[model samples]
Target: MSQILKGGCYCGGTTYTIAIPDKLPQVVGTPHKVPTSILDHCGKCRKTSGSLFQAWIVVPKPWITITYKYKEGSGGKLVEFQSSAHGTRSFCGACGTNLFYDSSKKKAMVEDMDGVVYLVNVTIGSLDEESLTHVELVKPKLHVWWDHGIGWIKEAFTTAGQGFGGLAKYPTGDVRQSPEELI
Candidate 1:
């Protein structure tokens, strides 16, 4: 129950089953709690993903294992990209499906309790919605690299209909408490 998690890419050409320990290793676990972000990557993500942003859940690399085939091309050949300083960007080169980023080899000076190399980020858009909904594994609480985010996105997520100013984090426990009272 603790080690198995599943997900895949947009076209299903690339699928992944990862093995994540209950206690993730250091580099992987470090970013999980402090508002790990979903980056629209200023418009780059829109162009690359052809969507709003590069939606991903950053987790511990060692906690994750590449369990399935990550292939590209019409022939189902191996597709990979030497992208980013942190890791490899893999996908179905045939369809250009953004599959996964393997960041385990990326150097992190910090040591983790699990003592494993970490891969870190996974695209949330590629995962199974039914599974994601139950776990809440990838709902982004904060948006980063927004200075370059889509123009309308800020307006959409930040629309002030209920007198909410759209700060990054929201308060907890009370729904009816007046803003003034809570503060």
Candidate 2:
């Protein structure tokens, strides 16, 4: 059988399925290992998710398929917001469930691949609970915008051993510095 991951919005108005690539690593004792998962604590992500940090699973756009269960007399469509100049965030129009984040430009290049590949960062929270049998695989590998994160959240990431050096730092003075300034 083909390996597939299924998920949907809170109200079930939006659903999706992802075809697991064979190239993805497999944990010996776990069902899967998401090699491209990361945690973002950027101001924009915090405001958008209303959380201290947002866990995201990055995958090629071609691997995912989305479906919308529109309400009676409502058009079946997912709402999208240009979160930044280079990225767009999508959500369920009916229930306002945040679903996806797509970059306007292809950010990475695959040497073996023929053409550019666009990546879509999906919120792990939107995934179906049952579909995440190997929940360990979804653990954030790295923390981005760590400097912008609250002191407690940054400490949590450090305790978890997922904090990236340089970017992750204890809050000292002003915490509103842009990520570019930190770099």
Give one digit per residue, the lDDT tens place, for model 2 in 1-183.
Answer: 446778888888889998765567433333434346788989988889988788888766777999877788654468899988998998888778888989878344433334566768899899888767756456667777888889976775567555554464535777787666765
CA lDDT of every candidate: 0.57, 0.74
lDDT of 1: 0.57
Q: How do all models score by TM-score?
A: 0.63, 0.75
lDDT score, candidate 2, position 76: 41
**Tens-place lDDT digits, model 1, residues 47-166:** 556777787776655555454353433555337776656556676645566766665464353343444434356777667765476354456766778787656666676676732345
**Residue 39 of candidate 2: its Cα lDDT?**
87
Q: Predicted candidate 2: what Cα RMSD to the true structure?
A: 10.8
TM-score of 1: 0.63
Minimum summed lDDT over a 10-residue window in model 2 is located at: 25-34
How many angstroms is residue 48 displaced in model 1 relative to the true structure, after the best TM-score fit?
1.4
